[model samples]
Target: MICPRCAASLTAKQRNGRMCAQCGKRFALDPAVHGKGMHDIRIRGIAERATDHGRLKITLTQLWYLSRSRNYAWAGRDPQGVPARIRWLVALPVAAALVACAVLTGGVLAVLAGAAACACVVVASSMRHRPGQSPHAQIIPAEQTFRDLMNGSWSAVYGGLPEGVVDDARPVPRPRGANRSGASVPVSPPKAAILCTDRVVALFLTANGIPARLEAVLVEVADADGTKGRPTVLAAALSAIAQYRSGLPVVVLHDADPQGALLAPLIRGAQPDRVVVDAGLPVSAARNRLGVVRLVRHDRLADAEQLRTVAGLPEADAEWLGEGFWSPLAAVTPRVLESIVVRAVERALAAPRPTHHEALTHGFLTWPQAPRSPRTSRAPGTRPPGTGTYKKKGTSSA
Candidate 1:
């Protein structure tokens, strides 16, 4: 294994886990934490996407699982055959209610009763509460947001990736009516970096939130061209370096794979002069912290070339990644992905507002300053009686 610190090869003769003969740095990946026992971890490598903590709106992946976990018309094509047990919980009751209503409540009442029972069953199925588990973090309805972000409209009939979804590769086409303004508007340079590892992710990120004619704050590195070390990445790398030189923070959103891990490093290599914080795939960072990678049976696994690319990872992590399967960055639902992007932007913007001098010397990040309106302040150019602001309506005091 090459030293992550020095990038030098290591001989396999060390007996102590702490010893590294090349760099001689004793970095222990795993450290025991005190729990009920001498506890090490609650989650070792990510379990095979196997149901962890969560609640509410789902990702495309989550929807796939939820569909498979039950047997119903809506359970999708569960080719794996949902366990019969799931039916007893929902379908069985609905069916029983239908039969009972047919016997007791003759007329349209029978159908209504059955429909009511089905609705109740659906609600019951969705109310997932288990001991020691937090409800899945609520997100803006994942399926809807993704659909809207992709097509810039939430009118999708279903919560799935639709064909011809607009993305970085396919931006919202300018309407024929858009030329009504006559002359073209000059394009503005992006103010911040929102790096995404894939085209879909970049499209979704750009498409999410208020639809704008132009996205001035978002500079995208939609690594859509597949290979990481391509001329496209070099273009993105150069742009990122340019942005870094201009004092804008680069926020990278990547998959939790070896290439994803390499993104920040690659950009950092592009501009060794400036500092760029890797707002990371924290799990990947966690893996680096412990020198381990979690293996999961993701519905989507990395292709052979991707797997081979990460194959040079340290033995333990490479084993975890190479265990015949892998997950995509899409494993992070659209909602969570949005939250991560927002936080990264917030962190960058939160850095002390640079002074004019700093703007000239260190370069400046452009951000609109917020208005400082006191709670009692009236709307600008509006003033009424007593308190130097508009008086409350229907109040005795002026």
Candidate 2:
């Protein structure tokens, strides 16, 4: 809790009456409000918005366990019971005095005895004891029970999460230059890549073998002059700087919302010839029809109007988003989404087919399919219709 007067951290010890150390003012805390709730109302509100309260709460509880487990193994500021120099300071003087005394008496053994005794005592006491817990230990474990309550909420929402996504979600250190799953990015850049708006979705896709990066999907890309049509976004911004100048096929995957609906246009601008596919979130029908487990929020996004104006969403889909509702990208499982994205890129890179529309598109024009030779396509005994094989004036036959 913050001090109403000066915003310093207030503790339970000073709950009733406390003085603000910074401003030197006294204030009272409300027992009913401060640090009091089954779950913090702010978080609970976000969780309950999509009828996913129980599941999110359980995740919060798992988060709590991970946090508390960290507390149990946390280290302290001070790491020694006493100063290490104290023992040396005490013994060095005593050893010097004994050697001085022995010099006056002309005794060699006495000097050696004093030096050895001092050395023994110094070695024994010089090792400082390990430090204890921090002064904040009193409040560190206070939320243990809250975590328990969250765990007991009985939510099955994790079924929608991709395997290993939740485990990797925990904030633990990974090897430098490696991603959350301890895998370094491939040396050869993928032929094409997938970009996601949310960091969580990016991490999930990257962990599951879809070459992806954490790139935000904005509702619209603003210009240097802050204009709409001349907008700039990640892929488009990179292209202007000659990044995807070779025309790399960029696939965009995002949540179902106004901001996501306009993601492709934002990346490709008015009209682009690149193989950038806007494989954004599916419509409500497609999501349900495909049995995609995603969380739908009956709320509005800040950029709802921008999407309706210029996103070019099909009529039925635009109507749904205009009514103010959305879904999180995590609603689609990582494996499911990854498979879809990989297949989309593969088809884009696959052999030219009879359909041939996309086969000729997306930078495959230069690498045209080889034309078949006359010998290869014809049967062994057959020849072109106009050329009869080895004519010899009817071969002087019959």
Candidate 3:
């Protein structure tokens, strides 16, 4: 292969990480595509057509174990034997109900009637909660505005954290030891940093009524704080899990579309402790039910296709689609903004606004006028106590 940018011959690259030597620009190439030259005889076979051709395949034994032992279904295949699984599942309760009813009603007729009722309940519950039911078949429940604000829209709601999610943010306190004799010592107050994208997420916590006292506000503000530096804006959202009661309810409110689907999981993955209630439109009648609904965009939104795509999202993807969905250039329709405002106000009513009001107020971040003080002759990077930058009378001049 040749480097597209620099027109230099591309050499064999490392696993999954490709490079453009001459231009120093790198593009990830399919791992399967490497070493298999386009002109190679192997190119004439089925390998060229496979979507996963770049991925290496494991042994059949491993595949079987993943499928059966762990009860995992491999990608690209609908779950097999779902009907049988459902019927078998439905049968257990049906039989139990029939036996119980017979004893209660004192006859075979009673047993048959009870069996019918049990069958109905089993069928309804299984269909409602079954794993394999296509997402399209699911009905979304209405949401309340207050609930949406309190719980947050789906993509923003709390949920499970991936392993090592908060490892980087964990505070590492300095050790205690002897000091005056030139020995190690313990640090006071213990410094720690809570990484976040900006003050927005932190503010969101306060808006939802969580305290911002030193308790959760340690230090640092960034999108991420981890071994791998993926840019994001919700490092401390995990703390919201403890602030809000566990598993009360969470609604993911976000733009509906592909990007939204991908973003919601990132937030959910960071907080493994809380349960995400749902992802969907958070209008007042949508709470307590499946909360998946399309966001109402603002008027004259430039990206009609994007807006349309988001609004047209299927219901089953409420969770996957609601995470981190942001489009800066897109104009949200007035209707959408109104809906958002309504939901937010409703939620705010549910709980008193979280602590740290200054954080939520934008002007708090506006640069403060320099404190007035006398001029000093100190050189750059050196200033005596109480030296201020602003002008004041009766101070030494340079």
Best by lDDT: 2
Over 188-267, each residue of candidate 1 has an lDDT whose tens digit, in order, gives: 54445555565455444433431122322444555554454434564766664473345655556665555554566555
The runs of at least 3 residues in candidate 3 whose Cα sits more than 4 Å from the true structure, single-residue gaps closed, are 1-231, 251-260, 266-326, 341-398
lDDT of 2: 0.43
**Candidate 2 regions with alpha-carbon error over 4 angstroms:** 1-169, 172-184, 212-242, 284-309, 350-398
Model 3 agreement with the true structure over 88-159: per-residue lDDT tens digits: 577767777766777778667886777777776676456532244222211111123212221232113223
Candidate 3, residue 155: Cα displacement in angstroms equals 38
Write out the backbone clash pairs for model 2. Answer: 294-331
Q: How close is every model to the real structure, measured as TM-score?
A: 0.36, 0.39, 0.19
| CA lDDT of each prediction against the hidden true structure | 0.39, 0.43, 0.30
Worst 10 residues of 2 by lDDT: 389-398
What are the runs in model 1 whose C-alpha is more than 4 Å off? 1-190, 210-216, 225-235, 239-245, 273-275, 283-315, 322-325, 351-398
| Candidate 2 per-residue lDDT over residues 252-344, each given as its tens digit | 666666656666665555335555555666544322232222222333443435655667555655755555444445544333455555555
